[model samples]
Target chain A: MSAAPPVIDRLRARIGTPGPPTTAVVEAGHLKAFAEAIGDSYPRWLTEAPPTFLVALAPVTAHLPEAEEYGKGWLNGGNRFEYLEPVKVGDAITAIGKLVDVYEKTGSSGNLLFIIFETEYFNRHGRTVARLRGTAIRR
Target chain B: MNIEPGHELPDLIKHPTTRQLVQYAGAQGDFYEIHYDQEFARSVGLPGVILHGLLKAAFLGQLVTDWLGERGTLKSFEVSYRGIDVPGRPYRCRGRVTSVVGGRAELEVWGEDPEGNRTTVGTAVVELTA
Candidate 1:
């Protein structure tokens, strides 16, 4: 009998080049809720969500249908973001994500799959708001 | 408030859990199961649900912002994910002043677990005034 393929193989098969983009409009309620939840009482964040909050609004690899099918062995590897402007309340934002890379590695815990995705956020005027590079690991 | 070059900021502890992950997901509008669903996380090969990257980064940002007080502004911040912030781990967010010039300060920041495992490493620049 053949052994199962590595997690990387499963991820590659599941996550293709990229698919249609998923977008969400930023709402004041969302910002306020986020600030309150995080216990961030700063006026800037409490009054309105910061541009970095756009990361929450932006599309992520975990959102991919394959992500759910991939199962519970995944973890948030890390993320990087470049904020262009302060995100204000009631701003309708749209985000787009694409698979950037996928590879496998051997660690003490066993085999792990590293997945990278790039997401871009745009405001209502179609202006670029921020860019995020998110990484996830599947063991 | 006066922050000199090489000044270090007090560390803040982040005790992550499945419930906090869910709260962060809901608060940040991130419904990604990897954050709250251990089953799904395991399906993906993770030991359990993990904290969000932004949440970790935010903790670092908070350290700088809090030190700078209400009158300061975060001009820019950036960080690289160094390791997994496994749920239930005791994590510490710390920062050290790198430079202070022209009324602006820059700091090197990072978060680590109780075991000294680095989770997130980054830099932040802030403008301070009286």
Candidate 2:
């Protein structure tokens, strides 16, 4: 199956589309679990979540529902993260995701559609913590 | 550690188990079946249950953060998922200082499979205080 034209139209129609900002409280347990899962023994993770932890706030692929129309199989193209401030354990964080761009490119395997999404994390006091830009490929 | 250009950072070797993938799935709220279900992964043309690209990216982040130590701060990081890394295989995260100007240091980081392929490649900028 090829990339759906309707999906492309829907994506272009909503460029810079913003997602409902989601908020989650950073807890010590969650940090520990993540560190442990990655076998990271850094004590700092106990206090501050890992740099890439912000992506967990709202995974790029699942952040937008319109994306589901692309295809069933999904792959991560890449991610860029800018950390503004440390994410403390007791901090209340708000995550906002937006659809940045969409396009298709023909790969050696055939055709692949790329979707780019950007997510910003802010603390309860409105302090920016981190910003993430991710790309997902649908085949 | 001296924050200077041309310095090589220590390599971080990681062996992500299936159980760890499950834990990561739980912690990150990413229940993507391809990351934890071998059947689904194979059905989709993958060799097996591959580790999350974000997870592999995290490993690269750790490589820099661990090198920066306590006072150093991670300012910006980026990575491109070029290849798929299967579970149970050992992956090495390596990086080197590309340049240091003022208190800001830049690094080139990437993850390599057992075969020495650069599976994930990225650049990171860090703020360091001497």
Candidate 3:
């Protein structure tokens, strides 16, 4: 097989892209595990549930072929989330993602590709639950 | 009980390891090779196994929840992944109250490596109600 091209270049070329929305039924086990993993014993998170836990559902939002293609080169740069409402167990959630931008910058380490993706989470009633903006870097 | 502005949360220390990375991947369903396999990670140009961004974010959530006790709820959180957190390194998660308005408290939070490098920086808004 031929050598693969620079992963950053391939991802940059795919900038301004938007992926499809993904939907999943929230289960109590998922929530409990997330709470346990983080050491969060908050009754709200444990009992009533926490809104920020919605992030645990991110991977279910739209498949990114590049994510599979790039592998470890892709780094989670950061994420910003706005919670409009709380998430309860058994709620069917839908999340949509869009690649908002891609750019290159020279850093102390070298050059980096900054990929920005935005995701919106909605509840069963179609009410907006949370909005997440994320940045991933590849060097 | 209400948390006043400037109330601080106890710091949480995490010793990241290959084991934790593996567990995080399995729990979160993130099968990203960089999180586990060292060879795949190096092929991608990473120094070694690195912690997941969500895992670090989860650490921040833990910091907040630990402080808020059992009655609190995390309303929202935002974070910027600043640097790589290699396994086998020690990290500490900390939060400080930044604002309290309308019975809601906002905190500026971050995780730092043993060498004092800020790996993740973010803010969390939490509501305390019993």
Candidate number achieving the greatest TM-score relative to the actual structure:
2
Q: Write the per-residue lDDT of candidate 2 for residues B1-130, one digit (tens) a residue.
A: 5778889999999998898899989888899899889999999888989999989998999898887888678999999999999888999999999999999999999999999999999999999866
**Which 10 successive residues of model 2 chain A have the least lDDT summed?**
A56-65
Ranking by TM-score: 2, 3, 1
Go through the candidates in order and give each one's C-alpha lDDT.
Answer: 0.72, 0.86, 0.76
Task: Give lDDT tens digits, candidate 1, residues B9-113.
Answer: 987776767777777888776776878877877776667777788788877877777777666667767777777777777778899989988888888999998
Clashes of each: 17, 0, 1
* TM-score of every prediction relative to native: 0.75, 0.95, 0.82
lDDT of candidate 3 over A11-130, digit per residue (tens): 666666656677887788887776666555566665444534666676633455564454336778887778777667777888878777767788786777777878888888899988
TM-score of chain A of 2: 0.89
Could you give candidate 3's per-residue lDDT for residues B13-77 as a string of tens digits? Answer: 98777887887676678888989999998888889888988888888867877777656567778
Q: Comparing 1 and 2 by lDDT, which wins?
A: 2
Greater TM-score among 1 and 2 belongs to: 2
Interface RMSD of 1: 2.6
Q: Candidate 3, DockQ to 2 decimals?
A: 0.50
In candidate 2, how many Å is residue A62 off? 5.2
Each prediction's RMSD over C-alphas, in Å, is 4.5, 2.4, 3.8
